[model samples]
Target: MKKLLSLFLMGLLVFVLAACTANENAGNETEQPDGEDTETAEKVLYLNNGQEPTSFDPPIGFDSVSWQALNNLMEGLTRLGKNHEPEAAIAENWDLSDDGKTYTFHIRENAKWSNGDDVTAGDFVFAWKRLLNPETGSPAAFLGYFIEGGEAFNNGEGSADDVAVKAVDEKTFEVTLISPQEYFLSVISNPAFFPVNEKVAAENPEWFAEAETFVGNGPFNLAEWEHDSHFIMEKNDQYWDAENVKLDKVHWAMVDDTNTEYQMFQAGDLDTSDVPADLSEQLFGEGKVEVVDQAGDYFYRFNVTKEPFQNENIRKAFAMAVDQQQIVDFVTKGQEKPAYGFVSYGFTDPSGNDFRETAGDLVKTDAEEAKKLLAQGMEEEGYDTLPEVTLTYSTSDAHKKIAETLQQMFKDNLGVEVQLANMEWNVFAEEQSALKFQLSRSSFLADYADPINFLENFQTGHSMNRTGWSNAEYDQLIQNAKNEADEAARYDMMYEAEKILMDEMPIIPIHFYNQVFMQNESVSGIVRHPVGYMELKWADKN
Candidate 1:
């Protein structure tokens, strides 16, 4: 398998090299000596995606609609830049109290929703209070765990209004934290933190949850959304930052099949989509395609509280047993790199080669050794034969194929019979969040470019920590790292916490995801940020 992967990767490298040369030649072919504009037609853009969004409400399902809808309909305290750092959005400037527990934000005075209402700090206050409301059942409420008294509030043990957020005035907001957090700004940029119009939402309680009910302060508004179909967003002329907004409109279509999207791009129906697996090489240097290694990771989570996987030895054995290279080559078609550690490569470290290299050693792959470990774990559990484990995944053929491949790998290596269960994407998400699955594959899009965003998920009480894995020692280390003012000391603490997770083996690192988009050469101003969101505000159809 290793040899095959090496050969395939080598071939892919050659193909990519040829593509790069071709692209360079094309650039030279189209070069205008100097001070020349190769401008073309303008303003409208067509976007293609796979899987229709399950909901437009940020507090509900996690889907493309939930993300794309917010781009035009709401504004958060901050927005992530291409580098994954927080930049000004509704809040223009912010300051942290010396103790790092209090944050004050100065709102952009001119910001307004599509309804023409001036955006006030009160709106953010109301939105956050509503998010922590136990009645609201906001799935991402765990994001508020950093806020003072948030956990208590979310648990229905305290009042929502008392959850550490206050509006000092229309243009100013203050947030008190339970403890100091290094990635507080990044967390604030998340969709769950986006501010909504309290009055409008109350008048039309169901509106905020529906496609047409949204009125945002974003660069675009939800013009139209067809369930299980496509969604359309039109430029918000009322956007406070409209002068910088470029695209007149954007059409987003959910398309799951890579070949289907490829065909759409070929027919000029889609401006861009992920490159198809079979045609990666042909499209590599073709003036119209763009591919980059994205800063994200895809991993499999084994529910630590569930049967079979509840055993630590089984978890560790599974983590060390799977061959990540094979999956990268066969499943993603050489689009992604094998992830050796939790943090993906390309993310710079404050001081070190990278977080992965700085903090740890990669898990060694040894099938025989893994089998021995599994047997020992089973014996320790007083079971002669391992219980039949069910690994769940989404309904897509690719996801199912990946799940089956993993099942077969375990069976072949460890003499364990594994079953595969597939569910629709949305259903799978609900099941995972509810701790209703034994094992599932998940992909994490970095909310920020820090190791904290990814590592925090495994912490106890984290909303996204569906596996039910937590260690008091690990949690303490994270909290200590946050409280530490010394940068080096903080990083060391973080590394120590990461080592705990690595040893726990609750998560099996697969590959760091890579983003691939196919577009026409004429499509300009499309920037791919590390967080995987396209800031269509500056996108130009020309």
Candidate 2:
């Protein structure tokens, strides 16, 4: 009996020991790092960018899409905030001269580029000079022309060294302007003023085109780029404020078709996508759409250098024939407001009055009056019948709808046959820049909140003025506005400039844009500036 009791005790001891060991192993497997669960997935944001970026190089990127990506990958001396106010980015603080003609910026010592290079004042000097270099052919070079001697250098009449930008020290950058610009701070927030690493750009001209060579000082860095499909950006560990950057990674998918992007958003593939015009109403009603009042305008420019468009009466007649209200209501589904002037609504003058309201409606649609004007124009041009006009737009379902609507309107109202053409975004942009189309669709988002931002584009020799229209009186008014110190006087001069622009009819205003996009409920903190660009630094994926 003593031997049997001893065997049973030994067996029980072994069984208890095995059970404890199994429990210990299970506990070890369940243990997490830092006392947090290990199963938590990585935070990521998936966005459909709508079109491929033209260039990530700051000086060359002038379009909205390119600016969107560049705004993430690069940091300027200042950044635009929610209300289009200038906020510090690389420059910790700045000083403006009493006359406001000079600005001195103190670079942040903690700022570091993705490649570990210290971002310095010299980078700003080099970037400004490079942009002003005529050989660069930067479309945004005009943005730099506000600086003293900038225009002269870009015109190839002055030496680059004569440009008024200089580095006082490794951390101090100075810029001298031609005159006191009220919106100078806001203007520098544009990507055109972003600094570039001199060493990287000198070594690789195609640095921005590839992931290996691209280095930026923003909150994110390029990780992988699959041409025409997508690109991924990982959080930049070296960013000055990386701790506050909630997203670990961002994936931008290039899906040009709005319907495809919407489908992707529905399928859980895209966290955010551009809302198609047809679906905007439905989405808004469902509380799935974000409507932003953008400081921009959607319009079509007439190539005044081209045959029939060269006639002022022809341009005015066509401009008056189109019913802007109908297009905005039916085509954009009332998402946008009919624009009668070049400057968009929402911008307030110094007197606290809306600029658009001050500048009233410059043009109005009257089908009967339009027919009379067209008859008179045809008589003046000594043509029995108007020539068939071709209108061009970028490839997108919304653009196609707008183009078709306009085509039908011209045919029905004026008895003029119209042809339509469409091309990829990049191709269309290039063709428009080269002035290769008779009539082409275009839009301009304000670089700043000032009326000069819109009025300056139509200046006599401005690169953005693809219509080949020029008037000395209009140019004088813009110059006067720049030099006018009194706020009321400055506004008066700008209003006159806009009047001239409307009378010339180089471009017909369609509607003022309201940013209509959709985002998943879980995605939050994606900052959309009043100027219509997305800031994703504070964005979080829940």
Candidate 3:
């Protein structure tokens, strides 16, 4: 199989920022209650992070900081644009062979890493191949499924030599694809495709986590990281595209308490933080806070390998009882959109066709119908009574409320008693990976603006596919889509695959996530990605 190239024109870099500034009125700053005097501010942005990042390495890391830091420091052949589409970064121009199986990239000669090392095509060749290497255990290997022999290589079913990644010259890279992939260039923008210095990573296994050893080609470098206290990233002067990079420094602090984070923002101790469910109205009154509504999804995945869940009727009954709109309104305080599909609503194809609508309709809410389905499933399984199952969620107050709502919905509608388990976020992740829980929360922010990025993760044996789901028909549908040449035909196949999943009821769609934040009026330049997380480069303190 040869690697395929789909041409995507690069968009000009646009640094969008919020212009609002947090200036203290004299009446508020002093007891005298004077009318006008206030002081100017410096460019410093403080953010409140809910989870402390576990690692900084792209392969082993899985958290906000890990991805955010990489996005700021390391430049990939392609990058995520403001529109969340793939745009050229290090590769100024590229070409696809007439066969549509070979991609030849021409690296920009002026590109350099933070260490002043020349950015070359060889770096990408190493990076892509290294990710497919079994020993690397990159959680990101799922993103490489489109490359020639990539899936087989990751599964240990093929030799690493079979994977088609080659460097034609210092500036030119030739990658062969097994099939033409519509999202191939968009995949390149993902961190899984970001280049790493082979010489450095090989010599120092602990390079990325250490400040001094960290080598990056992006706009900023890891200046300092203190586990629970704070981490800092300073601007990298040697970055290839440094001219457009702004902000001298970024201070990232981990604040687990939503109230504390809100207070920090209110007191001007922090420039930006997510608004807690309690304080949204108070902060919204000031006209400084804004919401980025089209991002992420909050849903629970049921591990189908579990006996009762293995029965499709049981899963369908469970999904049909819950009203996602109510969940969004009551639990998320109406800050989010109800999710009708697995992939987010804002996601689209290259031609700008919305996948959320194209993917078949999700399970409808019908309590009376749910009861009949539950009874039928139990009878078919020859069970005298309903089986007991547990739905697990995080210990956060918001999560608890949602879980309780779901539990009540199931009980009242289906007449089944469900055990609700709440644990800390870390514990929940560990248990989910271990398959310790029958049902668990599994939300995703699309790594790229493609349905393939979300859909492919659920194929059998993938790490993120913790539900122990396996289906020959589902797998074949994905393969057929990948091999299908016509764009419309391929998408139709994808839509069919999603429809099959919905019919099978393997997972429940809860709500499309909305990133809600309450920042002080004084803060400025804060921008949000539909993928979640704030991009600080464009941020400034007014």
Winning model by TM-score: 2
**Model 1 TM-score relative to the real fold:** 0.87
Question: Cα-based RMSD of the predictions, in order?
Answer: 9.8, 10.4, 10.2
Question: Model 3 scores what on Cα lDDT?
Answer: 0.72
> Which should have the higher TM-score, number 1 or number 2?
2
- Error of model 3, residue 345, in angstroms: 1.6
True lDDT of residue 110, candidate 1:
90
What does candidate 1's lDDT look like per residue over 240-275, in tens digits? Answer: 888988875666778777788878777666777776
* Models ranked on TM-score: 2, 1, 3
Name the regions of candidate 3 deviating beyond 4 angstroms: 1-42, 62-65, 281-288, 293-295, 347-353, 358-360, 520-527
Cα misplacement distance, residue 466 of candidate 1 (Å): 1.1
Candidate 2 at residue 231, lDDT? 76
Using lDDT as the measure, name the better of candidate 2 and candidate 3: 2
TM-score for each predicted model, relative to the true structure: 0.87, 0.92, 0.86
Q: Report the backbone clash tally of model 1.
A: 4
Best by lDDT: 2
* Candidate 3 structure quality by residue, lDDT tens digits, 1-542: 12111101000000111112112211222222343212221133556555666566666555454676667767788776766666788898789988888888888898887777888777887788778888888778877777888878988999777888888889888888888766688778767688888778788978887676888887777766666677667677777677776666666777777778878765555666766766655666756567775456688898888868878888889999999988776556646877777777866654677888766466789999888888888888988877789999866667777889999999889888899988877677778878888888778877766566567767788777788888788888887877888877777778887877788877888988777766656456655677654455555544
lDDT of each: 0.75, 0.85, 0.72
